[model samples]
Target: MNKIKVMQVVTTDKLSGAEKVVLDIENNLDKDRFEALALCAGGELKDLYEKSGIKTYVADLSSLKPGEIKKFRSYLKENPVDILHGHDVKASIGAYIASKGLGIPVISHLHSSYPWLQGASPLKYIDRFYRKKYKLSIACSHMVKEHYLNYNKAVSEDNMKVLNNSFNFNELKEKVILPKKEMRSRLNIKENAFVFGFLGRLLDIKGADLLIDTFNKISKDIPESLLVIVGDGPEREKLESMVKNYGLDHKVLFEGYQKDVYSYLNLFDCFILPSKLEGLPMAVLEAMAMRVPVISTPVAGVKTLIKDGFNGIILKERDEANLYEAMIKVHSSEDNRVALAENAYKYLVENYNIDIYMGKLQKIYEGIR
Candidate 1:
């Protein structure tokens, strides 16, 4: 039997949720039955994938260069693939354009809601047109599916699948074996300090500024509290400025983007994701799998995973005051934190295991083929 050739395309090789999903699929997909290859604009992701012995193609995806598209099309024509799997809007557009008249099935995964493009725009219509060409549209959450459906009326329910994001629990368990005390000491954090961690892109959509403001408000009350933000983005300068303005330079630490996030997760007492919008964030799941208590706004698929005061804490609003109160409530009692973390770990093991995710994804691919 011929193996199913799948070409996974992405905008960049950055350590983001969608990129990580693509990486996981490429690494773990059935090697005997599936031929998985990754195509992206060269970056750290490319290096990581190549190091893992996965084949990758680097193309300029930042702009719609005709030469780039022609080169990609020529390669696909010569070495045909059974499917073109795209991870982001840009990659979806590129795949749709490149695979035109090639008779190849294209599957585009929607990872987040695009609220900024709510109103009228030429790019919106163009994107919608290209999105409709996808044979399957895998949404990371129900909210993500709704966002695309609202924008692109041409997409039918038959083509859209709401497959929640997942994490490798066994791998995570192995990575978190380092002693918490050692990790904290490395970061210069005291043993007794209440460390609150936020890991994601420092974008306005992620609400890192809101988290900073909330941390600033509560830092005065909690003497030994620290806010450690992981990941880097365009909003770093602005966030750093806010920390400086609030005189929180001493209390807050920006670790930037560390490849080994599990080590940092071990150091966190509580994990917070204050995103204005999200699509089943993998960071929250990773923290939960690492047994770190999570506090996040009830947005996207978060409401599905967390019941307030049950498995995890959910902020009612996106404002700093609400987030600050939630943070304090979780910080006030160690018992509550442990209980939440326990429940979260149980929930992760039961539902969001990577093995289950890969099974469902394989079924989807087989069904489409």
Candidate 2:
């Protein structure tokens, strides 16, 4: 039997959610039935993919010169891949144009509700034309799907499918021992600290600044408190400024993009996500799997994964008072935190297991026939 050949394309260099999802699929899929190839914009992920024994391609996916398009066309002609998957706006355009005459079906996936109107983005009708050309559409969240289907007049709701991002949940039994004190010692986080960890690509919509404001409001009373943010993005410098302005330098730690995030996840007592909107964030899911309680804004896909005050705390919105109140409630009671953690672990094991996700994803790919 011939293996299914999947070539994936993405435009960013960061370890954003979409890149991670693509890598996870490549890492977990059945080797006998599938061979995944990756094409990404220049970044650390590109190097990692290439080093992992996968045939990886790197190109300027932002603006394709005719020469670049011709080169891509040559590669596709030679490879004759079974499926072409595009990960973001620029890559989606590159892919649609590259697959023009190959008769190869294209699958374009949207992991976030991209601000398509900003930054010289083509109008919704124009993107709808691209959508119509693709064989399949994957929206990373149900909300992301609705955003496209409802706003884009030309988008056929039936053309899109909603699939939450999947992760490598191969539960590590002999866990890497990251003592809270040792992790704190390295970061100067106090031993008895109440740390509210926020991990994700730092964006305005991610509500990092709101977290900073909330931390400021309560840090004096909760003297043994610390806020650690893990991940980097366009908003880092601005976030750093806010941390400085708020005098949270002593209590807030900005640890940038970590490759070993699971290890980092172990150091937290609870995870806080204050996104204005979210698909199911893998960061929250990781915290859940690692047995850390989560507090997040009530958003579309998040409400699906977290039952309020059960496995996690759902805030009314990104307001500082609401986030502060939720964290204070969790921090005030160890019993509540422990109960939420246990429930989160159980939820992750039952719903987000690696085998279960691969079974579903493989079924989707096989449906192409």
Candidate 3:
């Protein structure tokens, strides 16, 4: 029997939640039974994918342009894949169009519940049309599955399934081995500082600004505190300006888009994600796998991942006051921090391990094939 050939199509080159999912599938797919490849808009991820020995193709799949679709269609004609697994809307749309009459199954993997999919947006109807064309739609969380079912009545339940984001604990364990003191020194962080870290795209939806506001309120309370932000995006300059305005220029460090975030996760005293929206965040899982305590606003899938005061802190409200209290609570006790990390790590081991995810994903791919 021939190995299943899968091509994961992504719109962006940056490393974020959805992009990381594509990488995970590419790296961990069963080599004996499957052959994984990537088609990306071309950026940092392209290099990373190639370096990992996966064949990666560069193309702007973020648009519905005729040339872009033709490029994808042409590529499929020359070197066909069993599955064209497209991540998110644009890439899925491109794949849906390009794979016409090619007999290859296009899998739409949704990573978030976008606002455009609600209310009376034209995009929602357009999305509804293309969604039904796919062999299957994989929602990153149950929240995303419900969101689509609620608004897009045309989509059948039989055609969709929920698969949460997962992490490879084996790979994670290796990366977290770097000495904490060495990592802190490289980033100019004090050994004893209470580091509150955020790692993701610096976008408004991610609420990096809200995190800054919450940190600004409590920075004075915790004098030896540092807010280290890893990852970069359109909001970088805006967020940096906000930090400067709060006089947190010295206290805040923006370690723009890191290829190796596990090293940073290993050093963080606590990981904070103040996102206003999310499907299921990969950063939180990475943090949990690193055995780092987490504090996050109750976004889409966060409520499922964290239990307030249990495995991690879940903010009741997305405001400076609540976040400030949560930060202070964690800062006040070392025992609380250790307990949170332990529970989080255990929860990750039982629930979101890569084997569970890969098993389900491969089943979906084979079912479609």
Candidate 4:
């Protein structure tokens, strides 16, 4: 039997959640059964994929240009892909166009509930058309699947499937061997200080500003508490300014983007994600797998994983006051934090392990082939 050629397409070269999923699939797919290739815009993601021994093709897929489509179609004609797995709207559209009438199966993976294609008024209908053309659509979460079904009545339940976001727990366990004391020491954090960590893009939708405000509102109350934000993005300057204006320079530390996120997760007493929108965030699962306590908003598929005060803490509301209250409640209780962390770790081990995700994904690829 010949190995199935699976070409994964992503819109951006940034190492965001969606891009990470593409990498995860390529890294873990059965080498004996499949040959993985990545089609993406040129950036760190492309370089990383190439470094990981996966063949990658880079192109500007921001818009639907005839020349760009033609070039991509020409490449596809020569290489002959068995399956075109697109990670986002742009890549999905490009793949649909390039693979048309080629007898190739196109699978669109939905990583977010609100895709960029749906935001564009003129291109909103394109989502329906392109999704209909796809042989299968994989949603990162049930909520994401529901969003697509709601948007396009023509899409049937059998056409859409939920493959929740997962983490490489075995890989993470090896990386998290760093001691908490050593990690905190490197950051100049006090040994006894309660640290709340946030890791994700600094964007409005990610609630970076909301996090800053929530931290500021409760910083004075929890004097020994510190907020450390990992990762950087468009709203970094604005978030930093807000922190400075609120005189939280000493309480909050911005570590920017660290490739070794597990090391930082070890240092955290709690991981916070106050995003306004999400499609089952990878950061939350990573934190959970690292046995770090988590407090996040009830967005997208978050509610499916977090059972409010059980497995993890869920912010009832997205405002500063609500967040401040939740923070105070979690900060005041050490036993509560430990319980949540333990439960979250057990939950991930049981449900969201990478092996489970790989099995489901491979079955989809095999079925399509």
Candidate 5:
């Protein structure tokens, strides 16, 4: 089969969900069926995109400036891209203009629950204009799809599809020849202390503060348990203050970003993702693949992944009471915790595997003209 030259456009190269998904597709996708390329707002991921043998382009469209439109449009005409796929707002608009009248399809992938698209921004009025210009619109989850539907002036629900926001599983043995003790010693946790971990940007939207409050609530019960938070963002200072305020200074340890997260995944007894919104968090998927039971709020993509009591714990409220109650229940029961972890592992292997997720994308690529 002749490969379809598919170009994925992203607004930035931040090492997060969308960029990871783009790399997942580039790595696992069949080269014979798809010639993958990327056009991103330049960053650390540029080398990886280029090394994948995918042509990488950078058009730093400050998200405004009419010149970005002209430059991206001109690039499309000269390069003759097969499918112009956009991952964020600027890229969506850029792809729309660049692919104009060429019959090349543009796919807009909505990966967030941004309120601006739902009548919050004055720009919502022209949403239909950009949405309809594309050959396809993809949401990372159903919640994102419904959110966009409310403001989709030109495109219908029938035109939008939900694509994968998957985590790429590493094939290292379940027990790597890695040292849990060294990592634990480095973090200053006792060799035998119970550890509950959270890994993501320490942003307000990610609910890092809520995690601290919840841990505080159950601190007496899990007195020996240590909380290991592993990321940094704007809310880091606020969260650090809140943790101290709750008098969890000793129990809660904030370890900023680590290059290889998997190095620390197994050190924790459980993984927590307390977010206000989401597009299928890769961190949650990583936790599952590592057989760590996940306790998270009912965010978009997460709501569809597991039942309330089945594969994972989905809390209705992100408050101290509810989150702590859920955590206590899971922590109190070893059998239940193991059951949930086993189920989560099965779910990732069966459904969210990179190969299965990217195969669906390849089929979508083949369907486009």
Candidate 6:
């Protein structure tokens, strides 16, 4: 039997939610039945892909200029794949245009509901056209699928599948090499400290500033509190400046762009995601998997994963006061934190296991080809 060839195309070089999903599929696909390759728009993720022994192609996907599209098309001509699995809008459209005459099926994996995708916009129409051209669309969450469907008249329920971001709990267990005490000691955090963690790219839309503001509001009261931020992006410098301005140099720690996030996740008692927008955040899912309680804004995909005061606390609004209150409520009691964390872990095990995800993904790949 011939192995099916899949080329996972992504627009960014950073290892974020969508990129992680791409890596998961490329790394864990059945080796006997599939040959997985990656086409990264040139970033740290490309190097990691090559390091993992996967054939990787680097190209500029920042623009859909004729030259950029030609570069991609040229590569496909020299090394064709059975399927072009594009993560997000840019790569999906780029792959569709590049594979124009090749007759290879394209699959658009919608990982987030970008601002333009939420409502009718000129770019939304362009996305719809390419999405319709693709053989299938895999939304990272049901909310993401609804976002696309609510605004556009292109793809329908029949062509879209909601594949929530999944977790391999065992994989996480393997990555946590340090005990929580040792991890805290390394970060210089006191053993009695109530640690709140935020992980994900430090971007404007991620609402890192809001978290800082909320923490600042309550920092003096909770003298034994610490906020550790993981991940880096364009917004890091600005966020760091804000923390400095608030005189929170000691209270807040920024550990930029970690390759292994489990060690950091291990130190978190509570994970906060105050994202202004999202599809389904991988950070929140990781927090849940690691048995850390979550407090997040009710954004896209989050509404699906969290029920307020249930598995996690969903902020009614995105503001310093709301987030500040939520934090205080969780920090006020040990039982409250444990109950939320355990419920979140239960939900993750029941719905977001990686084994089930791969089985569903295999069917999608086989059916598409």
Give a tens-digit lDDT track for model 6, residues 1-369. Answer: 999999999888878888888877877899999998989877788898887778899887757777988999999999989999989888899999999989999999988878876666877888877777889988999888887788777677898899988886646655646679999989888999999999999889999999999899878889899999999999999999999999999999999999878778889989999898899988888889888999999888989898889899999899988998999999999999999999999998998888889999998899889
- Order the candidate numbers by TM-score, best to worst: 3, 1, 6, 4, 2, 5
Lowest lDDT 10-mer window, candidate 6?
169-178
Clashing pairs in 1: none
Worst window of 10 by summed lDDT in candidate 3: 169-178
Off by over 4 Å in 2: 64-67, 117-123, 171-177
Predicted candidate 2 versus true structure: per-residue lDDT over 3-106, tens digit per residue: 99888888777677778777777877799998979887767888877765668877666676667767788888887888888886667878878879998888
Estimate, for each residue in 205-291, the C-alpha lDDT of model 3 and write its tens digit: 899998898889888999999999998899999999999999999999999988788889888999999988888999999999888
lDDT of 1: 0.86
RMSD of each: 1.5, 2.2, 1.4, 1.8, 2.6, 1.7
TM-score, cand. 3 vs. native: 0.96
lDDT of each: 0.86, 0.80, 0.89, 0.86, 0.79, 0.88
Candidate 1 residues 214-281, lDDT tens each? Answer: 88878889989999999999999999999999999999999999888888898898999999888889
The digit string of per-residue lDDT tens for model 4 on 1-369 reads 899999998877778788888888888999999998988888887888998889999776778777877888899889998999988787899988988888889998888777543464656677776777889998999988887777667777898889999988656645536789998888899998989889998988898788888888677787898999999988999999999999999999999977888888888988989998888998998899888888898788898989998989888888888788888888888899899999999999899989999999999899988
**TM-score for each candidate, following the candidate numbering:** 0.96, 0.93, 0.96, 0.95, 0.90, 0.95
Q: How close is candidate 6 to the true structure, as a TM-score?
A: 0.95
How much lDDT does candidate 5 score? 0.79
Q: Please list the residue runs of candidate 3 whose C-alpha ends up more than 4 Å from where it truly belongs after superposition.
A: none
- Collision count of model 4: 1
Q: How close is candidate 4 to the true structure, as a TM-score?
A: 0.95
Clashing pairs in 6: none
Clashes of 6: 0
